[model samples]
Target chain A: MTTESVRVAVAQTVPEFGAVDRNRRRTLEIVRKNADADLVVLPELATTGYVFESESELADLAEPRDGETASAWAEAAAETGTWIVGGVAERAGASYYNSALVVSPDGLEGVYRKVHPWNEEKRWFAAGSDLPVFETPFGRLGVQICNDQWFPEATITQARAGADLIAVPTNWVPNPDGDGRPGDWTAGVHQAVAHADANRVWIACADRAGTERGTAFEGQSVVVAPDGVPAAGPAPADGEHVLAVDCDLARARDKSLTPRDDALADRRPEVYDLG
Target chain B: MTTESVRVAVAQTVPEFGAVDRNRRRTLEIVRKNADADLVVLPELATTGYVFESESELADLAEPRDGETASAWAEAAAETGTWIVGGVAERAGASYYNSALVVSPDGLEGVYRKVHPWNEEKRWFAAGSDLPVFETPFGRLGVQICNDQWFPEATITQARAGADLIAVPTNWVPNPDGDGRPGDWTAGVHQAVAHADANRVWIACADRAGTERGTAFEGQSVVVAPDGVPAAGPAPADGEHVLAVDCDLARARDKSLTPRDDALADRRPEVYDLG
Candidate 1:
């Protein structure tokens, strides 16, 4: 099988908390400059802020799936003709979901609800039920929200579902007690790399920055290969940044090696109850 | 307050393929001879050997929770008056569990089934439904089997459950391709160290060795401190070995610097439904 290489970009920026218009504008500016890429990703909850203190706060921040934020993202995708995946809050009737939306030149391709809600998020959003993978211009792409990266099963399931490239949009918080060191919040990145290596898939993780409600955002967006070898940014300090890399989707698929031979193929789901 | 240091012996040995009787005999001999240690640990699947062919093979090797294996282990514990934790095939009804039995001078204290089975194990064993932490003469200890160590949740849960020390019994296979090269696998050791640092607990991981059914076991048995520093062996070779270290439980409990807090406390489990 032949492989194809596509140029991918990760937009790393610091979005003001709850300042949707400002964040959206800043994101578009970055996306516009990186139009040469096939795919681009942004941070989790980039449309809204990370801290949702009350039900009123969450409800106020929530927007429809086809709301203004997604429409703006779709417009950028159409203009750039590049696939985009990023964090957004979705409003469906009386409920709200922490979700990542994927957009292409054609339109809003799909939306993946963040399956794992971290800490305060549990009080705000309901859990997502399905795992979705989409076929993109570059290859098969999978989307996972911020905290979802911590679970091996999330990434593993995506890989098994035939995603050559997995993209994560995260609002990763830097370890405040890490003696103010820049590279201290690397555990998440390392976990992403291990997931890529274990599944033989390329992973692109884009994170937002700036301190939101005293929690400092770590913006070390990174891209890793099928061998779990890091290929791009642990990007420089906050502000607006773009990390571009040539991702070989075909090569990832061709070099696909499940560490353990077809472990998923032999799963006896009936006998075991995960709940 | 004066802190006391206890002699902990981590038995990092390589068991012969499918040699349950021999391995048990060696374990008993080691326990009888090593009178200095307050606690001892053996590798995962130390009894039946790792990489068994079929469910029937695992079943054949499986012993009742209170059967021969437990009796022998309990005898060693009673004779040495040392707390022992080791892996064995646990048979209950028609189901088989790759379990770790914690045997002390008093008797069999607790059992933990391997939570996340790797590779071929999915075919022979069922995933554990519950996580259990037990109290021992030495300290409050948490037990996990093999791949469970890879996930932060397993260790974090134990810490939350008030475990002072975490013991992992693993039959870890070295990367066949990683002959002399060093990279992520070495850095991956930080995962355990991070756990120790974050939770202020001592972590002792004993892994098996030797090529069994074409799988090469990498015997990197290690003991890490509450500071996330190495206290003992990432042993040099894949052979019969013993790594001894002095673990101060009180010191771990006293450390003020921790990796858990609001920003760090950010974990979203509701979104991780795929697993």
Candidate 2:
């Protein structure tokens, strides 16, 4: 099952902390400008800030899967005739899940709640138990949010579930004492590249930029090919901008140089107690 | 025992393919400049390129651990009054092993052969079964080369054997078709970061860069803090470079963030039969 080539864009910018309306408007504007793209991505918690000071604040910003924010994105997708992948605080039952929503021309296609929460995220969001991937005009796309990117199992699961492209939306906070050095973000990008190389799948990562609530955002948003080479994004320190690139999905499925399945084919999971 | 803080520089650079003299000269220059650094690093097979189409070429580059090239680095370490860590093809018995050598201010401190031959490396180098770490002024440092970076068992073994910092010397090849975009090297860095984060230890990675023998190098030589944030080198298209950073060995021994030597503390090695 080969896939066709598609153009993807990663919108790297800083959203106002807890300013949902402003964030949505800016996102829509960026989406409109890149209407020609097959897929457009935005950062995790793009509507809400990474720092959730209180449950009350989370409740205020939390939205149902079919809420206004989702509807707005759905409408934007239909208008642009493109697929949109972005992060939002999802209100599921009595709890909230850090989720990534995939909106298509038809409407909301899927929502992937972050499987692993990092540090403070545990204080607010519940962990997701299920993993899912979906078919799109571009390819079989899998969506994951921030913390989920850190785990190898997360991306591997998506690949096992038949995902061709893995899109991660992240509101990554820059190291407070990193002294503005580029190395501070090595772990984050490492996961993305490893998954792409190991799974032989394309990865599109959109990261938030600029300072919000005393946290500086390191704007190294990026897109990687199956062999783990950066295809797009990962802009410089001051680059809080949009990056677009055309990617051939078939190229990612090349199994000669990097046998995607072979990397995980022999995994003996019975002994790995990664707690 | 309490450990003292020591500044170690993991020099990540791209060695010219089969350019032994030039690569060795560059290594000496970096060692000289980073004289104040307790330890300086170089990538795997620094004297030879990663992709050797024929066995003759591999054998031609293969040298004894006490050969001229290794001796040169040893002399440099003594002259600069610092330790040097790097990768090389070693001649052992009737076979060859991809090895990492730790040259100290006194002389060759220790040598570790690659435990797990990765991909093409299997065709060239024999695997070494033993795992060990050495004592240094900063702390106990463990050495591993390339593919060894992917396995948690290897790292956990080093930690169990008493290592404060795990230094990986790698000649990582970039995707042949990657167009030099950011975030292209996700897998390599991901393995390093996860190892550091999960182990709650520091990881000093020295990676090779530049296009040698038609293979491209992604120069994201990184230093992962005990907290898992990476202090990385400049993403150069191709060339020689050094990524130096100050590492606090004492902080790595802190039990608050990383409680060591428990069931949860050590990774079980019996389960992974896939590699």
Clashing pairs in 1: A115-B271, A115-B272, A116-B271, A116-B272, A117-B268, A118-B267, A118-B268
Compared with the true structure, model 1 gives a TM-score of 0.69
Residues B133-249, candidate 2: write the lDDT tens digits. 898877888888876665455665666566789898987655456545334443566667666664567888888877766667777778887666676543453566677777888
Measured with DockQ on alpha carbons, how good is candidate 1? 0.16
State the DockQ of every prediction. 0.16, 0.17
On TM-score, the leading prediction is 2
**Candidate 1 lDDT, tens digit per residue, A1-275?**
12488888988878877788988888888788899888989888887878777989888878988889778888998998878898888889888899988988888888999877766777778878766889875689988887676556677577778889999998876533333111443556656655666567889999887788888777888887776666787776476678899987875675423465432342333323223
TM-score for chain B in model 1: 0.89
* Share of native interface contacts present in candidate 2: 0.18
- lDDT per model, in order? 0.74, 0.74
